[model samples]
Target: MYDLGDIVEMKKAHPCGVNRWEITRMGADIKIKCTGCGHVVMMPRREFNKKLKKVLESKADQA
Candidate 1:
């Protein structure tokens, strides 16, 4: 499972050739920032779920 501030990998690489993203906001829509290019993207929770591959790092774990 992913939560705010978690680093995650997506099923497909981004156009920037990076698959890792950082969760920035969460709600009905989730906002993610590209780790490679620093580009931000917002998508519906359902869509995010479908594209999400795995959680790389969790905020809770860091705390």
Candidate 2:
């Protein structure tokens, strides 16, 4: 499972030319911030699962 502050790679690239995003919030919906353009988007977990490529780093990993 993904938690807040995790950096992840998406299956597709963002328009801003970044595949990396940081998880800012989690619940029934998930909120992620784009690392390149700094855009924030909120979507359901199912949609997130479809879009996510892999978890690059988690808070624990960073620590």
lDDT of each: 0.96, 0.92
RMSD of each: 0.6, 0.9
Q: How far is candidate 2 from the true structure (C-alpha RMSD, Å)?
A: 0.9
Q: Give the TM-score of candidate 1.
A: 0.95
State the lDDT of candidate 2 residue by residue for 1-63, as single tens digits.
Answer: 678899999998899998999999999899999999999999999999999989999898778
Alpha-carbon error at 27 in model 1, in Å? Answer: 0.4
Superposition error at 9 for model 1 (Å): 0.3
List candidate 2 stretches off by more than 4 Å.
Answer: none
